[model samples]
Target chain A: MEDVLKIGGKEIKSRFFVGTGKFPDKAVVRDVLEASAAEVVTVAVRRVDPDSSDENILDHIPERCVLMTNTSGARDAAEAVRIARLAKAAGCGDWIKIEVINDNKYLLPDNKETIKAIEILAEEGFTVLPYMNPDLVDARRMVDAGAAAVMPLGSPIGSNRGFRTEEIVRIMVDEIKVPVIVDAGIGAPSEAARCMEIGADAVLVNTALSAAADPVKMAEAFSKAVEAGRSAYLAGIPERIEEASASSPLTGFLR
Target chain B: MTLKINGKEEILEKEMTLTGLIKDKGLNGRNIVIECNLEIVPRQTWGKVDVKDGDSIEIISFTGGG
Candidate 1:
């Protein structure tokens, strides 16, 4: 069965969401994007000179992919709102990934500020996806505030620590009404697959792919792993047991 | 007259429209947003709005990030 991932009234063919940061070069970005077959990609906005005819990052992204702009530098809701408005005004799209981080040490997201940004952006018809700590109450609040999806971090951003918050993310995946996308600190394909196996709607990977020896090949690996895990989940794996249970009968062979 | 653009001071020969400044900087003004004096200048108003002496303008564009 071919299952489609839908976000904000649009049908997405791929469950993998890739970030276009930390790549060796723009060429690698295009190659990895094409290889991953991801329909959603994240971008950040920053100051630019108008007179300089520099190659814009917008030009690197293909038209088929949805550009999900993020408010990465915003420390509070007001700043996030401002960035979101600017992103929309720039003709990027209505998709905004609300990332509000006040913690400088760990770069942990401020859940309250994220929810605040979501409430405002959602009122303006923007599809809001808030990056949040794996908190049940905040996840519920984000849903109530019209978040299109809840992105709970597995660990700190770019830490390469896999599934450090697995239990909490599992709770979010189980309880949230919207899609639970496991983002950040996912270092390997197996970790991403594990997330899918636990019923996560998707996983956002950046560091693991970009930091690999060959980003394009790693992107392909991740895509396949995501598909494999999703299929396994759909097919329903058997539950684990403490004691040994023989797959073959104990007395039936040659007796 | 002088204006601070993207944190750099530049002498303005005459009053320049926001659109003119954008074009003078070699940007086509698409896929970018401009803010003048802490307020977002809509694309439509870029032509009508004029940059005054000591005006601070910030121009921003999308970049690859997570």
Candidate 2:
């Protein structure tokens, strides 16, 4: 709302960066994305498919959008670094989404590995957008470690839950200079919009739309919701006061 | 088969279907990117993709925080 967030000199208009997975198909993905009007789309690199290269989804998305490569499978800093390099070798090194999960059940990020990865990757000259915790200490550590921006998740990744850490997100927004893009657990468009309204530089949505019945239409809804929230935040909504203000001065008259 | 998912191995009862393999490895529905034998599984057919014996499956899931 203040001036949509910019990450690593990339002008990100929509706070919602959609993941290109979980859709029924790429054509459906494209249609849903067109509806969402998201400027950035997230793509992860895994094996290239032992069987075929005939129909590659990454080859299909709109060309103008930013395609971010995530270190999704890396277990430790070393593994993440390897994936980052692989992403570079694969020609998507300019933007890297650093995700180093150690815990299996909840799939929480190993802070130590993540910081290590950020430090290592930043030294390698890659623009790192580390997905991290809302803890201000860790967020600062990540930024200090050379992360171009802090992608703090509102909740666990793919939880499709609302901002569980609203207080921490607020703290990060108040403290960090680089863009604070709210990533993960945004269940609906309003959730994305709410984060933007709360001063988050951007928001990332994947599971919510990808698993939806009609992704493209849902994407459009998310796009408009994000915009509406941004616009509302810019406009400055009216204050809430359930109780009426006392017009008669009780104490002042004594003066 | 010499395949390991998250550093553990189990014999496959049948050919690998993207859905079953991901589920078998305990990554049923996650924010993971899969690579089999060095090839990436397309987003769409993760449900239908198949993996063979001795094939390598690498899956990366997202974590919370920057």
lDDT of 1 at A188: 93
DockQ of each: 0.81, 0.06
Candidate 1 backbone overlaps, count: 4
lDDT for each residue of candidate 1 in A115-188, tens digit (9 for 90 to 100): 88999999999999999999999999999999999999989999989878889888888799999999898999
Worst 10 residues of 1 chain A by lDDT: A49-58
TM-scores for every candidate against the unseen true structure: 0.95, 0.74
Q: What lDDT score belongs to each candidate, Candidate 1 first?
A: 0.90, 0.75
Residue A168, model 1: lDDT of: 89
> Residue B6 deviation, candidate 1, in Å?
2.1
**How would you encode candidate 2's per-residue C-alpha lDDT over A144-230 as one tens digit per residue?**
999999888878877888788888998998998888888888889888888878778778888888788877778888888888877
Q: Which prediction has the highest TM-score against the true structure?
A: 1
Q: Report the C-alpha displacement of residue A84, candidate 1, in angstroms.
A: 0.4
DockQ versus reference, model 2 = 0.06
**Candidate 1: residue A97 Cα off by (Å):** 0.5
